[model samples]
Target: MKKFWLSLLSIIIPASAVTFEDNDTVVLLGNTVIERAQKYGYLETAINLSARKKKLKFRNLGWSGDTVFGHARSYFGPPKEGFDRLKSDLTELKPNVVIVCYGAVAAYDGQKGLPEFLAGYETLLSMIKSSASPREIVIVSPPPAESLGAPMPDMREHNKRLALYSKAVGKLAQKHKLQFADFFTTLGESKGLTDNGLHFTPEGYQTAAPKLVEALGLSLATGNQLQSEHARKLREATVAKNKLFFFRWRPANETYLRLFRKHEQGNNLKELPMFDPLIADAEKQIEALKKTTLSLK
Candidate 1:
């Protein structure tokens, strides 16, 4: 009995590798690479299915073409406003884990932008830390674009610069003692997975999901048909909840609701609070599913 107890203790608390705790709120932040994940639900599914001992909440805050400075998130305003919004979002979410994904698009600027890129990344980190102190921050390298046999018009050179950025991301992770995941090296040669050599096809996300979990030093449950079915259901609920949150946070018709041109359609603002209940209901369903055992068999 003593031996059994000791074994269980070691398994419960491993010395190395980052681990998520019960009820940890995880937020994924990045550009199109991360934004598109909402449609596929691959990564989110993997994380939820793998998290055996905990109930985790996830919020995806991905903006297509966004940079480290929150450029894409800024709607009819300066980058600083966008940055402020990012900070506000983080503050509101109060996530326990934040997965930072960037570098690929910024690499488009080439070697000349490396310094600025890193500086912006560092500033972003500062903002996250300030808002969500004592949180687990995982840095994920942008996956490399596929070449489809011959290098496609500067694609080779783009990948070369991307490698540099990936290296820098790894270094940053080490410096901060944060977790690091390299999609560039791991997701290499994504021939059919990508739609246009860059964005992932639905199948691509399915393939990359497990890799993301592994890169983070997490384990996946031995998924079975039953588990898979349940995962699908739970993921669908999660996606619904995320959508509600999105509307609440960044409404589509913000111009009239909260921005400069509000007088005309300001009454529509009443609809915003309606999402809260829907989001809450979806979350409840997710939590209920989490309580069930997700055994492979």
Candidate 2:
């Protein structure tokens, strides 16, 4: 099994591609596209499998409806507060790599919002640099929106805006000397990738995972390998770990747990750290699963 796995790795991941070091923590920051990734675990699984020999940690800090301003993450506070939370999370996670995924939501405003989007993204990158001081930062362009025919309104015009945003993202990556994952160009218009014209379905994530791995300069896993029982187990373990981390960071009743209304359950804050051990346990499971070989048959 070990020999088989190594042989597969050699073919998929090139020696020149970027690779994670032992104990490296990678944080994913963005909006719905990123947040939804946690549910499927395809991206995380692919990355982990590619670096099976190393112990890597992944933290998904994605929020639905979030922007470069961190608006959706703000909760009851102002957008600035959301930005603060982002900094706080980065500080706490102390990631070695930070992957920033924005621009899709911002592209919604079209030409009218491009400037502000870029400005906000610049600020967001600066904040990540200062707060986390990660060794590497990756900027990911959102995948192109699909046109699912009649009822699902054509997204060609919107995709044009996304293309503009993707180009800007590439420029930013170059300016900052960071890595860029241009999904807009790489993934293109693949039918059935998304349920609607925008959001990815589970299969969509599966399809995009290798593209992400490739964009990051890592080895690409074949669909058959990714669908193997071994891979499924690893992905399931990743999803479990992510769930624990999510509840730890964003408790359902945060208003009572850590906010102004915390007087009622502030003491429960101690329970938050309790999730650390459980998350660690889940990660252990993932690590163990990573060593197992996928059954190509």
Candidate number with greatest lDDT: 2
Best by TM-score: 2
lDDT of each: 0.79, 0.84
Tens digit of per-residue lDDT, candidate 1, span 1-297: 999987533322222445789889889999998988887677887877677758788889999999999988888888788889999989988999999899978988888999999899999999999987736898888888776555444368788988888878777777777778877776766567787778888888878887777666676766342237667776677677777788887898999998888999998999988988888788788777655536435
Worst 10 residues of 2 by lDDT: 8-17
- Residue pairs of candidate 1 with colliding backbone atoms: none
Q: How high is each candidate's TM-score?
A: 0.88, 0.91
Model 2: how far is 174 from its true place, Å? 0.3
What lDDT would candidate 2 get against the real structure?
Answer: 0.84
Model 2 scores a TM of: 0.91
Model 1's TM-score against the true structure: 0.88
Instruction: Pick out the ten consecutive residues of candidate 1 with the lowest summed lDDT.
Output: 8-17
User: What's the lDDT of the predicted structure labeled candidate 1?
Assistant: 0.79
Write model 2 residue lDDT over 41-118, tens digit each, in one string.
998888777775788999999999899998788888777898898899999899998888898888989889988998
